[model samples]
Target: MVSSTISLAPFFSLSPSASQSQPPSPFAFRRGLFLVCHAFSQSESQADKPNSWRQLHWKEKRPRRKANAISDQEVVHQFDQLLAAKNLYQINQYLKDHAKTSNNSYPTVFSLFTRLTQAEGIGPDEYTYAILMDCCARMNQVNLMFGFLGRFLKEGHSANNAMIFSPILKGLCWEKRTGEAATIVLYKMAKLGCIPGIVSYNIIINGLCKNDEIDKAMDFVDVMMSKGHEPNVVTYNTLIDGLCKKGEIDKALDFVDVMISKGHGPNVVTYSTLIDGLCKEGEIDKAMDIVDVMISKGYDPDVITYSILINGLCKEGEIDKAMDIVDVMISRGHDPDVVTYSTLIDGLCKEGEIDKARNFVDVMISKGLEPDVVTYSTLIDGLCKKGEIDKAMDIVDVMISRGHDPDVVTYNTLIDGLCKKGETDKARDFVDVMISKGLEPNVVTYSTLIDGLCKKGETDNARDFVDVMISKGLEPNVVTYNILIDGLCKKGEIQKAIDIVDVMITKGHEPDVVTYSTLIDGLCKKGEIEKAMDFLDVMISKGLEPDVVTYNTLIDGLCKKGETDKARDFVDVMISKGLEPDVVTHNTLIDGLCKKGQTEQAFNFLDVMISKGCDPDVITYNTLITGLCKNGEIDKALDFVDVMISKGHEPNVVTYSTLIDGLCKKGEIKRALNFLDVMISKGHEPDVVTYGTLIDGLCEKGEITKAKELFYEMISKGVDPDAVI
Candidate 1:
């Protein structure tokens, strides 16, 4: 608080006028002795008693000065050097001690440096401020950093003082306190009369980009240019990288043009940033173009460049191309590292080439690249997805033996796999093992377990587990709510599902598309179509668009009610909204039409379907045939069956059995018997349904002898007839 000066004389018993004051306080004496021993130990040699502090006045002249003394230059020169050196040393030790332990000493030692230097008429140099600013930044003490900045500015420093701002900027930016960094440079530094130079601006720009403030970062680029600070490649790269990550890759590439026009041509990092952004957008070909451009610019694509392409390719399900790039990467003398191998492993696993992925892991090990936690995690996740959970656990054991600590992601994958395989009890045991290994269960971990428990028909246990998660301070996320909602729906507890949805909203959670879709589907399945419609309206009102699943569920409900026309009308609405109906939607409508005896209308729907890019599969044809048989349009159905075969669509047993049943129902018992022989010639053996359908049709026609013959033949084929037969 005493900014005027720290009178070192109060700490020492250095009083020539002894009668003027009381004895120095014990606290003052101890502090003075500590300062003398710590700072002025070298000056003690000239003391009369070599311990008596009467001659010392910190930077005071040897004896008390009245008329004249050593010149100010002589006194200041010696005192400044001594003060700066001692203060710098003390400030460094404080920083070192604080860096290792608690940094509570920041204020204590920073005050000592500034005050002692000021009292000695010596300005604290860059080294003094550098250490202090870094200490403040590391401690996240912004106020202390600004205090040092104010002092530095007061010393008439200018834009060239990067040394002052650089460390502070790095510290703030490193901690992602970029907005504060920009505040200091954009407003504070200028207010203090030190217009920020390019380095300070660059740091702030990178921070802004890092904080996802791409527009703000771009606007600052203008400020940098207006202030006559030419934006360097780093500034452009930072802005471009941010823009790309935000899915503004085109805007990023525009900056690439701007950068080159300004003569700060993009470097490896700039090109790599663009490549990564393009690849993330699934523009792998565009990324390759960028790579080619980099080579044309005499900058060879580095490992990161190729890895970005590989990652992008793999994501697009282009694993073959990703592997080709791996070969290309090796030929370029840039060996694929663990990251490269891990990405390939992940890609291969996703492509269901799990065995190939396993072999690649061994190849990585052979190449002397010890798989890190990520590599092991990728492999474990792959094995888990393939339902080789025991293999995943074995990998985990091997990973542990090799000193690779399986991260939470690894265990979560395993737990999820077990849960999906209906091993909820095993999953619970894994959760305990995870805790024993000092791995805390995160939201995903707990959520997966809750889902597993709910799936195993343990709804009460899942509800209790939610409380346990809350007790542990892990809030249930939207996925967790959706999983529980699904479980409640499956149990026919519609009210509970609605109540949970309400709770989700009350808890400040926005029910996303999945949440609404699950509720709608559940209601549809339970034949609560009107309630499902109500949910649909609420979902739209909440500004959430009804996705394909939402629309499909409602269509399915209408179709199941034999309201094919209503379902057909809903499909038009979906298309009007630019939501293309998937194959499931078309098939649902087809089946509905068939059930309502509109077999011909179902054929018309199929024609309209192919034109709209929704292909009718085997299920669609089977539904139409059943409708025809029920309508006594047996011969026309036979011609359609020939059309199906000519179109390379094989009619399975459903088609054959439907035709034979139609014939027998029409009292063409002999023709139906011959059709059965045709079915056998096509390598299609009569199963229980096929035999039952024929037997029922024959009995209804009063052809007991033919029915008995078919019954004996069915028994010879080992086809057990149902009670209906």
Candidate 2:
């Protein structure tokens, strides 16, 4: 009602493919029903019914009752009785008696009914075979469906009939046989005189779209138009959905205009697909803009649309804003499903707001939405991260008690937590537990366990686990190799790590940045700087450009070796590669410069940092203060601390302690004690290092009484003194 129109083509016909030979009774019942229906169309006037009935099977005149003489229930009851008794003859009679609307919705039951008949050696009726096609679709038994269709056609039913072709065509589509489905719709159906109607068209188009053959699907739309079939609303919706899924939102919107022009209204599904696509593409604002348009079109956004937006916002760390949308969603009469609540809970947990996340879980339950495996996993994962493994285990118990099976993710979370806390034996035990529970360990499971074993210096056991993973038919991915390599490097088994890299590359598992980085760092730590550079060159040749971590590792190694000039040159090379220098890069450089007595050069670089819009953080200032103090520029260091404070950088205990130790080293006891007083007044809590510095200064000055007094003060404050004190 709102737009323009497109032309429909002529309904092209094909020659009948059936042979002249008489077919068996399988087709007899089917052919009779269709012939009867065709002879007397539904659009025919009721007054012509009696005459139409007399023409059935070309029989002589007989007393004829009105069509649909028996009720649907009576026919169903008759069929049920016949089927239950396994009466083949009566069932045959029953099928022949009621080829009507009464049995339409119940045709799905024919698969089981026919199988029951098969037990009694009774062959299925034609309609039974049709339903069996559907049964195969349900079971994803594509080949069996084709076999059934072949028998149906051999029994002499016209294969070209839209009724005959539709089931298998739809079944093929259901099984994701998009290319095969297209073959049938384009060639086989055309040869059989069966031009696909909108239903079959939509099925193939949907299959094509799902297979990411949207371009081909669009080409099919043109073919349909050429065949005089105007693209219907379902047709257009499928195309739009396909485009949206392909991340071509602009194209999808343009297609909507085409749809509107065709006078085929965009339905809820059409707009919802667009909204979901937008959210996934991280275009939430545009998605909301489309939502407004959808609502303005008198189409109310359903739960799916709202949930998509909720999840989108959550992923973007817009939890408060997402909750606001959730309120709006509820007020708009859409209930938040488990997915929506799970997404929100996950977002909150990621932000380290565990308590807030747990409260939301309660609210979700109060709304009658049961927490699914994903929800429990999210909560358990959050608790584990916060080092509350006991609470996490309690949730695992609750998850089981609530009848939700703990999935791989759940166990993975527990395993990861145990690994981080160095309770790896427990992590090892959980693997067996998961297997006992009938849950297969995925790549993540094996990788995590291997990493844990590697961390505990159980590399041999980690290797055995990798074998166990392979034996269980799991392929170790690049990350699994990287973990092993890193472990080897840490244990000073650099050759073993390099061998793993070689094996990975030989196995066609191209080494990624982590793999190369781990090897480079290992070689660098071994003082094989030349080898590390060779690997860097190899990595570049392979087009794996080194990231900032790569540069940082190299620079740190060079600085540690007192090769400050080489490290500085490496930093310039790193910058040339389009990698920005991070704080770690700056800190490493400052430490190197200060050690080389280039403290002024380090301070000059600080100006360069500010000029480049890099705010000098506490670590930045701490390094500078340490550097200045080391170079015997104690007053300059004190002035730098003021500058750090003026720049709004809070001086940590390390900052103050560095200065105190400097003054103490210079035998400036009174000055050091004064600085300690200023540190205490500035709300800085003294650590053992801080107290030890002051104590050592007093003891060195032969002020044993004052040192003893300070030691007791440290003990009273619960700060333990060093052995030196």
Best by TM-score: 2
lDDT of 2 at 113: 50
Give the range where candidate 2 is weakest over 10 consecutive residues by summed lDDT. 1-10
Tens digits of per-residue lDDT for model 2, 1-725: 00012111111112134233322344443343233233223212211111121132123222233434666466557666676787766665455444332323223244335444445545575666655555445434454455555556665666555655666777677667776777777677776566677777778888889889898899888887887788998998889889988999999999999999989888889988898889879999998998899999999999878877887888788899899999999999888987788878888988888999999989988998888767888899889898889999999999999887776668888999999888888998998998798667778888998998899888888888989998987788899999999999988899998888888888679999999999999988998888888999999999998999998999988888889889989889988988788888888888888888889889887777778777879988988888888878899999988899898988888888999999998899889888888889989988999888888888889999999999999999999776776
lDDT of each: 0.76, 0.77
Q: Looking at candidate 1, what is the lDDT of residue 11? A: 15
Clashing pairs in model 1, backbone N/Cα/C closer than 3 A: none
- Per-candidate TM equals 0.76, 0.77
RMSD of 1: 15.1
RMSD of each: 15.1, 13.8
Q: lDDT tens digits, residues 451-513, model 1? A: 998898788899988999999877788988998998998888888989999999998899999
